[model samples]
Target: MIAVMLEILGSALLGLGLAAAAAVLLAHRLPARRLVLLAGGIGALLGAYVTHEALGPGHVLVTLLGSLGVSAVVVSLLLRPAAQAAAPAPAHRAVP
Candidate 1:
């Protein structure tokens, strides 16, 4: 049981990392939030499917929700700073 829990944790981390990478790459072409959402959704679906295949459908919903949360956090952490840095500073207005 412990080993199986560790395996699930590892799988979740792997899914998070991959989704983060994909969201970062997609950030070049799409808005960061959109990319993150897209990646998270995809990761969740994939994770759920894989977990279902390996562990049975009983685990699918939990894995799907967990992966979605993990992927969103990973993407936000990886891309939010980059997006902020890339954005232009607001122009200062002179007092009349």
Candidate 2:
């Protein structure tokens, strides 16, 4: 039980840290800050839960690593290319 709780806490922290770093490094490529953060946290939590369930207890380190990996993947999926500048419209001429 305690291990599970610790795993969750550690995973969440790792996820948030990863998200923050991505947001800072890939700010232009990522979406809104709030969305990134939320996704990171939730993704890590779910990852930890899934990993723990699959591998069972006594694998906290592995579970946290999995959670971090999952969170990174999830955040990376949200990345977008930098926006391109729009071309200017041509001037209209009056008809004779």
Q: How well does candidate 1 score on lDDT at residue 32? A: 59
Clash pairs, candidate 2, are none
Top model by TM-score, which number? 2
lDDT of 2 by residue, 41-89 (tens): 9889989999999999999999999999999999999999788999899
Clashes of each: 0, 0
Clashes of 1: 0
lDDT value, residue 79 of candidate 1: 48
lDDT over C-alpha atoms for residue 18 of model 2: 95
Show where candidate 2 strays beyond 4 Å: 83-96
